[model samples]
Target: MSLTSEERAYIRSQSLARLATIGPNGPQVRPVGFVLNDDDTLDIGGPKLRESQKYRNARAHAEVALVIDDMAPADDPIAAGWGRGVEIRGRAELLTLDAPPMAPDFFSNDVIRVHPSRVISWHIAPEGQARDIV
Candidate 1:
């Protein structure tokens, strides 16, 4: 399902996002700090010039999955009761230092721009049904 503006906003407000990329060997996952830009693009900062496999994979495939969720502890039995999760599927573009209107400090290394193609979300429910917010 597509994501609503509000839902997307909520996802963006979260503290962290998990990035999934595919490499020649297999899938790679990394935790990243990010910012949701006003232009409806996700800005990911990390060093790209360095020999990072994830960046290399993104440069090659462009397709990526990003997941953001609220913190819920397993020890807290009630945690599951509070359902809050978001998933985004999109094409990732590497932002170079030469890119215009750059915010290099957003990431410590390099930055990746993700243009979402699909978004799905779920709010807490006792029945555990993940309904599409869009």
Candidate 2:
């Protein structure tokens, strides 16, 4: 599996992630809404996505990184670790849907699809074990 059951659950529980891309000047990072598909791919769609610099960057340079993460609330006395996260290093491609976008609430049909080549997870598994897939 591209992601373990626990990892999938962690991803589904979150609503935001940081998408990093290479721009003309340097690396650009932004908060983005994403959809994780059954095929283990990530779809990032937004209004006017095609006009954004990120889209242009992905089209020109496919390499990218996405990070979804959170820290335990201070009140959660029994929570594991100081943080939990997943980092995906992958190749991204520009794409469009036929009608509705993957995230229909406030996104458009234009999207960037990320096919993960390597995954790094920390503080997600029980016993706080970290793993890497490359």
Candidate 3:
């Protein structure tokens, strides 16, 4: 299913996200700390991080995919059986300077901003399919 405004907003509000990029070797995955900008751009910050392979890969390819989800089980086991998740497809761009200030401990390096092209939401069904709920 497609994403609703609320689901997209929830995905942006998340603090932790998994970024997927195309590296010289192959596809690379990393857990990143990010902030959602008012303009719908995702700001990722880290020290020395800007020079990392992920950064280089993004610069070369630009295309990226991100996933954010709540992993904790709900108070009710039945409710917990259903999983909630958000996925974003977008192009990543390197932010050189004048970026917003993040917490000192937020990300140790430079920031990579991702502008989403598509957003989708998912839930675990009783039959166990990761069904798109939105």
Residue 101 in candidate 3, Cα distance off native in Å? 4.4
Per-residue alpha-carbon lDDT of model 3 for 45-90, expressed as tens digits?
A: 6667777888999999999988887753666343364556777788
> What TM-score goes with each of the models?
0.71, 0.90, 0.75
Model 2: per-residue Cα lDDT over 26-130, one tens digit each: 999999989888888998888889999999999888999999999966654435447888999999988888854456776888989999999999777766467
The ten-residue window of minimal lDDT in model 1 covers 100-109
- The alpha-carbon deviation from the true structure for residue 64 of candidate 3, after best TM-score superposition, in angstroms, is 0.5
Per-residue lDDT of candidate 1, residues 1-134 (tens digit): 34566566576568678899999988999987677776667876664433677788899999998888885445534345365777778899986645423345434445777888877766633246555533
TM-score of candidate 3 versus the correct structure, residues matched by position: 0.75
The per-prediction CA RMSD against the true structure, in angstroms, equals 4.5, 2.0, 4.2
Ranking by lDDT: 2, 3, 1
The lDDT values for all models are 0.70, 0.86, 0.71
Q: Which regions of candidate 3 deviate over 4 angstroms?
A: 1-3, 76-79, 99-101, 105-109, 124-134
| Candidate closer to the true structure by TM-score (higher is better), 1 or 3 | 3
Which is the winner by TM-score between candidate 1 and candidate 2?
2
In order of TM-score, best first, we have 2, 3, 1
Error of 3 at 80 (Å): 2.8
